[model samples]
Target chain A: MKALNRYARAVAELLVLFALYALGTWLAQALGWPIPGGVVGLALLLLVFALNGLKPAHLQLGAGLLMAEMLLFFIPALMSLLDYGALVRQQGLRILLVIAISTVVVMLVTAFTVDAVFRWRMRRDT
Target chain B: MTLEPMPLAWLGLTLLAYLGSRWLYRRTRIYVLSPLILVPALLLAIAAPLHTRYAEYSADTHWLMAVLGPVTVAFAVPIWQQRALLVRHWAALLLGMLAGSLASMLSSWWLARWLALDPAVALSLVPRSITTPFAMPLARDLGGVPEMTAVFVMFTGVFGAMLGGVLLRWLPLRSPLARGALFGVGAHGAGVSRAQEVGREEGTVAGLVMVLTGLLNLFAAPVLERFF
Candidate 1:
């Protein structure tokens, strides 16, 4: 019974997640909002959680379990690189070059800029 | 028009990949180089020899990617839950995100142009730091290829999560709040997840920054494209 209940909860979490996802998509499309459906639904669900008053016990298990394995969902998509191998080969050097160079650039700039802004804010506060 | 069932083929593959990643994480301590990135890259190399095309595989699986928005938005829950922290850090957070977003955009553009990449390819890289679903579609509209954009987005996620903590340690900066915010803005969903693993306070800030900047990039991207 304990195992069965756990299964049901897992299923329920997925159902709510996907339904909210679909609804968010539907609402966004219908309203022509700039935000995506999944994002909208997630936001809506968060609101519901806040208003409904969640129990730490009620949510901790489900959200934790789902999030713990979140990275798993992304794997299938990366295989798309194989289909585009030729383009990647032709553009391979450039793609790698761009990704490599831009990654460092993005990382550094992001870190520096974020640090600078915080420093500026701290100074202002004081 | 006839609609088909969600592709079981892709779903199955994702499941297998997930299993492999879990096994790896258990055996190895390389939490930084996540299974999501490594497993797929491994699958690609091994399966490429088998000639399994990405398009055919992604055809049905693309539905999975399509859910990027909700998955991303769900992150807002933790962000909202930490509303007090946000209010406290509002000034610093906003200022940091603004600088982070612009710096990310400019650096990506500069690198793209310097490499003389195809304009579309260059455009796609601009949003690589954003989550895949949002970045992929936006890249397509701006003349970037979805498949390629997907690849870079994955790479950015993996790199950010894996090296982000280690790298941040070496930097001169010293605030967990700032570090988490930077990770979210620069790395998006994956980074936010990694930030959560590191600590709750950082996770909260990172998750909020990711959502806010993702929304910002929707606008920032087009303007940056024009500038390029």
Candidate 2:
């Protein structure tokens, strides 16, 4: 009976996600592809969703909830920084610089690449 | 290791803290800043001042961080659904990733060393643009602390979400695909989420970039480590 409800569907989707991830992971390992198993799992799930008519529109509740509480998932990992506290204390400035610069670089590069692609595509079309 | 009650308690407390921060931030019209981004930061900022050691807090929360891997794996659902767009841009994406990642690594490295940062910290900083889940493990494996990487990645996310648009305007790039891809690849989760706010196409590109960038970082970090 629960399986017929929205909550049930959400759970089922999550289960399917996990199963697909395992399958993808296994397949990649078997095939010796450089890609991660989760990537493969994602591809598989995307296929199923496409064929079966499941979409982001359908998973709104679960996805919204997941996004809303997304920070909850980072807590344990945040704790891991404790191991690096000494390093941070000793070289905090350097660490800060790296993070800041890398972020800027990524942002600029992405923007440029997209811009270039768009310009190229438009030129070709003309 | 034996499963302890603290692991559960840590999760419970983290949930409480996150919810509490969300409620307070929402009521204050600070919609742009969420508890998820701020609270952990507040904890870190005030850690020494509050006399609450990260070591103590981490002892209770390590298992919670471990969940990031599985949660990341969960992203497969959205990705799977978006496969059509991915195949369409396969070649462009591949080249863009190589270019984006190489630029990111070299720039971060050059900038940090120019600023006279230590090697370990520099290593930590290299992967800040990737999602925290992937960034943390790579950071840890590369001799950077996962927690430090988490904080760094979050900072990058918050910065991207907060200032990316302003930066986007100032830049000369006119292609939405490249811009969106850069947002996702460079900013990781927050960048992608922020891109979603701009429009559908941007979000799609951002999501694609996040996936490819993650894959690239998985292999690229080891090669980059040699230079450090």
Candidate 3:
């Protein structure tokens, strides 16, 4: 009975989430908004969450399932590399080098900036 | 027009490959063994042998891509879960994200230019630091290949997460906010996972920062694409 109730609640939660997603997508397409429907739905859902329309506990199970299995959904996109043979063959090594250097740069600069601001705030507060 | 038939067999193959690779990744904890890399390699190995084009594969698996939109919507949950951190560190968060996003964008463009990559590939690199869900759309808006952007984003996440750990040692980040922001701003999804291993607060902050960065970039991509 406990497990049943939990599963049932999860189903309801998933319904709400999907509904918001659909609505957001519809609105985006209809209104011709620049934002993606998923994003619009995210904002709308966040708004609902803030207004106390729902609790995190209510959506936890459903949201967790979707997010945890997300990699499953992206496999095809990754596999789409089957398409760009010429590009990959010609520039793959260079693209990798660019990604490595840029990633390191972003990390160092972001970390240092955040640490600086944190220390500055602490000093001002004191 | 005749619709392409549902690719049940290919779908099954794709699923088995991804789930199996994930299991393998868990056992090894090696980045090379990860599903992101393993799944693609596995599929491509079969694909090339069979001469399966990407369009044929996508026709069968687009349902997975369609769900990506809803998966993206689910990010709001994590961001909401970390509202207190969001409220407390808005200043640090905004400044760090701006610095990181700007740095990543500039560095990617310069590197792409320095390497003389095709113009399309150069633009795709612009959103490489963000997570896949956000990066793919942004890449398309900028007239870059979305799939290629996904690969670049994946590589960025892997390198950023790996390098973020090394940077943490040399940097003077006392607070969880700074430490997590390092991963979040640097690596997005992959960094969130790495940040979770460091500590709970770091994980929370990293997750929040990642989601917010994706959102901020989504809102700004329209204008930023013009620059690219």
Candidate 4:
């Protein structure tokens, strides 16, 4: 009975989060915004949280639950591997190589540049 | 006798598999054993041997995917938690993200062209560095296939999550904030998760960078299409 009540509360909290996302999506559509409804929803959530309209504790349990199991959400997308069999067969090696190289390059470039700028600013301030 | 797979069954299977894999990861502390890698492989192994079609599996598991948008929205909580860091470094962080975003876009474009990939495929690759939710629509707007963009985004995420730490060690990035931003800008959600494992401040910065880079990409996609 205790476990059941906890589960019920979690479900309720998740529903509240979902409702906020739905409202954000609706508003984005209504406004004809180029941004995605979910992202708009995220922005709204951030705004509310920043302004103390909602407390972090309110979202902690539900959001943590969702984020913890986040990878499960991508299973369907991964399953789409079945659809891309042909593309994978023909250009799989090349695609893999490009992705691998580009990932490293992007990581290095972004990190180095950001660090450089930060260091330069520090030096200038001193 | 064969039994039809019900939606509840699929949901149960996914949750079980994810939990099982996650438990293994916790016990071993092995990066490769992570649910991101293990769960998909385990499901693929099961589905392949059983000859279950992707569409059928997806049909039953669609509820899991349906919650992704709301979960994404909920990321704002973490960002909100780091509100102080965001306000302090807003100017420098935004400039870094803009630079990083441009670098990602340009490198993908050049690399795709150098490999002589099809125009549509190359266009799809343009948004490969951003998160999936943002990448999908940006791909469509830029005349790229959304599906291909999704695949690319996954590839980028997996690569960053798996090998990013090693790369960071080799690079000159000593500050956690810079390392976190790099992961977020380069790897998106998976990288942010990895960053979170490192430290709270690191994770918060990475999450902020990921969201900002994604938003920047949304506006940059159209302008980028003309150049590519």
Candidate 2: tens digits of C-alpha lDDT, residues B1-228: 222433555446666777788888768746444765666665556454545556567666665564454455566555665768778766566667777777877787688778887676667777777877677766765776566667777777877776777777777665567768867877777788778877888888887678668767876666756665
lDDT per residue (tens digit) for residues B129-151 in model 4: 88877888788888998767877
Model-by-model DockQ, in order: 0.48, 0.46, 0.80, 0.62
| Top candidate when judged by DockQ against the true structure | 3
Score every model by TM-score.
0.84, 0.79, 0.95, 0.90
CA displacement after TM-score superposition, residue B219 of candidate 1 (Å): 4.8
Task: State in Å the error of residue B203, model 1.
Answer: 3.6
Query: In DockQ, how does model 1 score against the reference complex?
Result: 0.48
How do the residues A12-121 of candidate 1 rate in per-residue lDDT, one tens digit apiece? Answer: 76566677778888998999875667667766777777787553345445555555565665566667677676677777777666665565556666667667767777
- Quote the positional error of residue B34 for candidate 1 in Å: 3.1
Ranking of models by DockQ: 3, 4, 1, 2
On residues A1-126, what C-alpha lDDT tens digit does candidate 2 reach at each position? 655797787776556555665787789889987555665655665566668856655655554455445577775556555456676677776666566667777777666665666567668879
List candidate 2 stretches off by more than 4 Å: A1-4, A19-68, A80-90, B1-9, B24-32, B42-55, B225-228
Q: Which residue window of length 10 is worst by lDDT in model 3 chain B?
A: B1-10
Residue B210, candidate 3: Cα error in Å is 0.6
TM-score of chain A, model number 1: 0.77
Interface RMSD of 3: 1.1
Candidates ranked by lDDT = 3, 4, 1, 2
Docking class of predicted structure 3:
medium
Deviation of model 4 at B151, angstroms:
2.6
Q: Could you give candidate 1's per-residue lDDT for residues B18-82 as a string of tens digits?
A: 68777877688576435766678666766677676766676666666654554554565555667
